[model samples]
Target: MTERIGIVGGGIVGIAIARALTARGVGEVTVLEKERRLAAHQTGHNSGVVHAGLYYAPGSLKAQLCAAGRVLIREFCQEKGLPYREVGKLVVAVDDTELPALAEIERRSIANKVPRLARIDDPAHLRDIEPHVAGVAAVHSPETAVVDYASITEAMAQDVRAAGGTILLGHGVTEITVDGDTVRVATDASEHEFTRLVVCAGLQSDIVAKLVGADPSPKILPFRGEYWALSPDRTDLVSGMIYPVPDPRFPFLGVHFTRGVYDDVHVGPNAVPALAREGYGWLTISPKDTWESLRWPGAWPLAKRHWRMGVDEISASLVKRLYFGKARRFVPELRMADLEAKTASGVRAQAWGRDGSLLDDFAVDRIGPVTVLRNAPSPAATSSIAIAEHVLQHHLDLAAT
Candidate 1:
């Protein structure tokens, strides 16, 4: 009898893992999703920028997976006849203080083995690349690109289905219990018994992990990223992706301009604490979920460390002009009128450790028949293929044991 595998979550990462497993003929794979359609959460709402291993720590899973996955993604898109383009990105140093950090990112790129990462020393070059940008110096990463991940997710899900894998929508896994050789997954629709289970629940990862009896558990603190679209007439003011050198101590990349594959420019994704896990806007809070977040020991430590920055981000989320004003630093021609609230926001399922430290790397934990992905943030979409392979290899090792 073929081993049956049940996967929870229907986002890009979940489907990517399913595709990888099915392609390898691992087993009969089934994906469980609560939403009526796929990619309704983080995967659907992401900025759709193909990362170039710029901000990740050198040699970490994020750096390795993103660097390797960028190549895989571009190749997959080309082969599948999907629309994607390497529009490149510019990380500018707006002042003297940010120059060192910008330089460090260049050095890290070399260590991460990203292709054609050059530091632009002349403002003339910056102006040539992005005509209406302000910067003394910048790092030009030509490997960066943009593509709709929702489309990519849909493609992967199709592959999963064609490979004889079943994708079950509106099947939210409400109860998970593992005993002996059979693992039972109870969803709202029905109960499924499988030989093994791989849960990539995204925002609900920790919740599912706890159900399967795992420890040293990290809390998935949902962070809302808000974006604004450039008025159609002013779209020409920005070209390619423009980013600010991130503060070393901060977890987020500062606000900047990004040109979409659709030829529209979007800016600003200021990180703010989200009241709901899947909530895209303010005042959308689940009391139970909010209580869990507030009670988590991990939450207080992170808050204590970045209290001021957190306060500022929260304030920016409430004020639209403050958000756009930050973006205008690069494109001075950008008027308050140029920025308008785009779609619903994307929620980042950021994991925080027990000590309250934000887990920066890809944190995967396995115990017996269960494997759970704890923290997988930016570049996760870019690194989906490589990460899926890693997870499969782990499963293979367990089978050998």
Candidate 2:
């Protein structure tokens, strides 16, 4: 019997899976996206950096897939004539206080076999990489890159279409049912039945999983990250990407500077609790989303543990000076005027368990004919293609072999 496949969400990972199924001739494939356009959410709103195998724990899925996906992305850009910039990245320890954390990052980088990874202790060498930046030491990944992820998503969609896969926009999955060997999915406008179903429903993963009668232990927490664009004239302050050693206690990387593939410099992405799942700013609020989050058993524990950092992030979001202060720590030359305007912001669907601990790695759950992605943030865009292959081989079909 031929396989009939249905995919939820039209983000890069979802589209990539559709494209892979088509390429493998795995029967009829269809992609459902809630938005009218692909990559309308996290995929489009990301920093556009192709993450190297840097921060993930050794032997984790993130570390493995990121190493593979980085190569695949560069090659895809070449074949599709999309812009791919290898602008390098420096993870700087701004002072002695940050040295221990920086060393752990270096250890991970080397264990992950990050290409061309280097450690610099001399302040002058750090300066050579990011001039006008103050740091006691640093770990450099010179092959780190930036690209247009949304464009890449469209390109993959083209492949899926070329292979006769159907992609439906604005088709949010409203309900899902499992009957015998097939999964039935109803959307806002239409319905589909497939031999197998894969849910990559970014921010709505939990809701969709609930529809399938799956465990609801891990809930999606909306964390909005805001960015500021550097004045075009002063973009030279950043030649590539300058980053801080992330706080291990939290999943967020601190505010840093990045030169985008288009040569625009952006600062920030401080994480704060978002009132709505899709909230992009302070004004956007959803009572249902907020109340659900507040009442979750994990909410208070998570907040109690990180309230100080949350306050700091919330403070930074409300005041430009505080945000500037974070960025200023990386680049001493960064002026208040240099941060010209607020750029696009993205809300990450951070998955937290009932215990309130963030899932730090990629997570997938299989419920008979349906597979749901519970936690796929950050390195997800970088690992989209690999993620597709993993899902197809492990979750969707195993008997074909």
Best by lDDT: 2
lDDT for each candidate structure: 0.86, 0.92
The 10 consecutive residues of candidate 1 with the worst lDDT sum are: 392-401
Query: TM-score: which candidate is best?
Result: 2
Expressed as tens digits, the lDDT of each residue in 338-398 for candidate 2 is: 9999987999988998988888899999999999999999899999998888887878764
lDDT of 1 by residue, 78-113 (tens): 988898888999999988888899988988887887
Candidate 2 vs. true structure, TM-score: 0.99
Where in model 1 is the C-alpha error above 4 Å? 396-401
lDDT of candidate 2 at residue 160, scale 0 to 100: 98
Write down the lDDT that model 1 would get: 0.86
